[model samples]
Target: MYWSVVFPGMTEGQAKWLLPRAEEGLPGLLGSIVDPNYFISLHVDRHSAETMKEALLLLESSDSSTESKGIARGLLEAVDDWLDAGGKYLEE
Candidate 1:
């Protein structure tokens, strides 16, 4: 998974903390009433860096609710901070 590789040092607690906000925001970006848990389960093992990038692009272009945009931005900022702290996937 991209997150696993990119955020090798992120703790479960951190993920728990961050994911809920992302989930809350994603429905707005999708423009539908989506279940956050289902979304998280789907992406947990399947997401790639490109996927996230595309999602961000979609989020940027989509006519989403303000709450969604704000949450997505916050999630991205948190990820950026983690990356800045030297998080990387372990080489297999």
Candidate 2:
């Protein structure tokens, strides 16, 4: 679940609700699929690849250690590169 991925400490219910609200704040059109309203947008468009420069947007604790922050940034950057076209695009 989204919680396990980011907030490994939150309960099941907490994560489900937190993820969408958190996702909305990401930095790109790609990670923009947080809101359920965008399901139709994503489903209808098969090749809507995208990415978000917004990392560390975890709904979990904001005050984390430097190592944790590095890990978060690394994960976000990796996902961004994967979804984006060399970090130079929006959803097509």
Winning candidate number (TM-score): 1
Q: For residues 22-84, what per-residue lDDT tens digits would candidate 1 score against the true structure?
A: 768767432123344465533321234335645865795689988888877776665555555
Worst 10 residues of 2 by lDDT: 40-49
Q: How does each model score on TM-score?
A: 0.40, 0.30
Q: State in Å the error of residue 84, model 1.
A: 1.2
lDDT of 2 by residue, 1-92 (tens): 02113333555467567667666776442232233334322221112322233434561247888788787777566555555434333363
True-vs-predicted CA distance for residue 8, candidate 1, Å:
18
Clashing pairs in 1: 5-89
Model 1 misplaced stretches (Cα beyond 4 Å): 1-54
lDDT of 1 at 85: 60
Each prediction's total of clashing residue pairs, residues at least 3 apart in sequence or on different chains, is: 1, 0
lDDT of each: 0.54, 0.46
Error (Å) of candidate 2 at residue 27 is 39
- For model 2 the TM-score comes to 0.30
What lDDT is obtained when candidate 1 is compared to the true structure? 0.54
**After superposition, candidate 2 runs with Cα above 4 Å error:** 1-55, 59-61, 86-92
